[model samples]
Every structure is written in C-alpha cells, then in structure tokens.
Target: MDPKPVNHAAWINSLGMSFAEVPVGTGSILVAREETQERHLALFRRSRNQPFSHAARPATQVSWTEAVAFCDWLTQRERAAGGLSFRQRYRLPSDHEWSCAAGIGHLESATRRPEEKSNRLPGHYPWGRAWPPPQDAGNLCGEESAGDFPDNFIAGYQDAWSGGEVHARASGPNPYGLYDLGGNVWEWCQDRYREDKDWRVLRGGSWKSARRETLLTSHRTHDPENYRSDSVGFRCVLAEE
Candidate 1:
C-alpha cells in the first residue's frame, strides 16, 4: 500500500493559508493566512496565550477572542496571497456550513418537527439524535484519520474519553475527505464567539468527551470571551466561492 502524501504547502494553499508550527498560540498549530494582511487588519483578535495549558482544556492556553479573529484573518490572507476575489470573501464556517461539508444535512432536515417551524432545521446535536444507535455513521473527532473505524461512525464522539493531545493521532476521518475531525479536539467556529457576550457556539466534540451529544454536529457550548479550555482547538475553512 502506498503512503499518504505530506503536502503542508498544498493543504495550506488550498485553504488560502500559511502555517507556523510553534508556540501554541491558537491552542494548536499557529497559522497565518491572507486575511491578516489583506484587510490591513489583525489576523487573530485575541491570539493571547493563556498562562495555564492542559490536554483537556487547550483554550486556556489560547485566548478566546483570538480564535474568532483567525477566521477573518485567514480569509483576507487567502485573497491577498491566493489571488482570490476579495469581493467574493472569506470567513469562518458556520454550524450549517460545517454540517454541509461533513455530510450531516439530513439530520437537520429530520429535526424540523411538524409542531415546530416548518422548513427549519433541527438546532440540536449535529445528527439530531441524542444517542446514535449502533451501525450508524457520524464523523471524525479532531485528528483521527478517516476510515480508521468504518463501523464506528455513528457510535458517537471520537475521543469519548481521553483526547488526542496526549496522543497526537487517532483513527479514521470523514466523508469530506478530512481526517481527525471526529474526536481529536473541539474546533472553533466562525460565528461571533457567542450570541451575546457570555458565550459562543462550539461544534464538533473533542476526543476526551464521553457524551455522544457533544459529538453531534448541532451540539453547542456556552463559550465565553477570554475563557479557554483544553479540549478547544480550531481549524480554518476557505470558501471555494
């Protein structure tokens, strides 16, 4: 069997980004994209590293505000560097966008009960199921490769227990041809970090999480500004548009 390709530049270029693997600034790998330079603004709003760091709560090591700004920064960086259309735009992926990319739209459709708003997608867990039954398909955690556990897709959150920080790699990936998204770590979303000031919505559960609900694409958390946790981490998305 052939080996997987190692194309850091290609991967970064695809997302219109550039990465620097040092100083866990965002609580993970430090990435610089076109957004930081193009808009002539700051890449990460917070980007402040916390004093305390742990495998369970990575965010404490990364500032809550900086995580949100990274998306805007990445977008501008991509356009400036990749030569993409600035008018077209770049931004963080919303929960819906993430669901669409990870192939969990049907779950949203089913949750639109007859009593509730028509044509409204379910706002609960990613798949809308409290507990995914056996033999169903969910997605990856944080850093696990796809197809690692083909039958365990719907079984729930990737890490259900200890996270990937203690162990960098994990099993399998997802339908989107992405890896380790299921249970590696909790990823940051593009939303304003919260509906109000107290919290924001964090999607995709972490490896250390045991609850199947957290693994659901629709699952959310009351993430606050300047507050960081160990399980929290982030990935950037580039709109082909």
Candidate 2:
C-alpha cells in the first residue's frame, strides 16, 4: 500500500514533533528531529516532576517500557485521526538506524546485531574528528557542568547552556539535520545490546558525559529495559510496517 503524503509543518504544529527523513540501506525512515519533549510525553502519560521543568526539555527519567508505550499511544492516536495509514506507525529507531541518523552509518561490524558495532571510528566524534570538541557541538558535560557533576565533565569544553542543563533543540543539528544526536540526553534504541543479553541499547552521549570514550559516535551503551534515569531519554521514528 502507498503511504499518504505528510504535511511536515502541519504535523509539527499539531503534534509538537518534527521529523527528518534519513536513508538506511535500501529504505528510509523519518526520524524525530529532536528528542521527545516533556510536553509531548504529558499528552499520553501523567505529568511528573522532572529535573528540567521546561516544556521543551527532553523527556528524561523515562524507562524503555514507558517509551514503547508512548510510541504505541501515538500510533493509535494518529491512526484514529486519519493522520497515519494502517501500515504507518511510530516506534524507536533501531541501533543501526540511529547510527545512520547520526551520520556514522558507514562503519560496519561483523557482529550479527548491528548494535554490537562499537569503537570502529576511533578519534572521531559526531562533530568531526577534533579534540576537546568545538563550540555549539551539542549539550555535553563541560566546565559549567562541574557545579552539578563535580568530577564528570570535559575540562575546557563549553556550550551556550549553563550548569549541565539539557534543553531540546539547544544545539545545532547534525549533518542529517537531526538535533541532539551527540548530547543533551542519551537516546534509547530498539535493539538489545547483545543477543545473549536482555538489556536495550542507548546511543548518543548526555549532558553528564565527559570522557572522549563515551562521546564517540561509535560508542554504545545499554541498560535494563525497565531502568530509568535523568540522563536517559528517547526519540521516535515514523515508518511503514
């Protein structure tokens, strides 16, 4: 079945979420330009006291289960409203899809699950291969972050935001026009960390990450599916079934 044409502007205004098309292998998927915000999450789930009180901040302290539930809720709501076709739905991007959106899709691994591909592009970062990072290179832990995370922060790197704060769309978009691919908050992916583990994968660094090892685009991390943290959040992908 053919998919309906999407009115990007109208969708953004109505849903408060914008997406960017990203090519993967033989097909493409629409990736949310920014992480899911608190305002959006509140539409489906009850409001809770979040560390960042701003409506535009990434919705953190969300478990993978909650995130999946949100995607299901959004799919139902949009389909009911005739905004999405039967074959179209919202879900978290897979680890490989996340890498493609982050502009590091070229690095392939021999592992069966693409999520296991890590540390392939050494010395390279989301903002290009440079030491100490450049200005406006997403919301990473820097000197200003020291006040909150006394020991975990880049020594000299700094961005516009202060006090290790996380703000959605605060940093410049990546080459794919996707924002916060490297920082602001760690984003959840659909795949498990490994075939033998039940842990789900997470990509992108967070405002609390300071080490070069963690900031690399090839870096991969995981947590139990039910785990939640102030630094972990997720973005959604719109694709055909």
- The global C-alpha lDDT for each of the candidates, from Candidate 1 onward, is 0.41, 0.81
Clashing pairs in 2: none
Looking at model 2, residue 174 earns an lDDT score of 72
Q: Determine the backbone clash count of candidate 1.
A: 47
Please give the TM-score that candidate 2 achieves against the real structure: 0.88
Across residues 44-127, which tens digit of lDDT does each residue of candidate 2 receive? 765334333338778889999989988998998889998899999999998888888877775654244745477667886877
Q: Summing lDDT over every window of 10 consecutive residues in candidate 1, give the lowest-scoring window.
A: 33-42
Error of 2 at 201 (Å): 0.3
Report residue 33 deviation for candidate 1 (angstroms).
16
**Cα deviation of 53 in candidate 1 (Å)?**
14
Question: Whose lDDT is greatest here?
Answer: 2
What is the alpha-carbon lDDT of model 2 when measured against the actual structure? Answer: 0.81
lDDT digits (tens) for residues 1-241 of candidate 1? 2112222332345423443221111222222221122122222332334233222222323334665565556566667786556654444455544444444544454233222222233434433334542222232332232244343343333333222342232433333334334444565555544344555555556545445555555555546656666556555555545
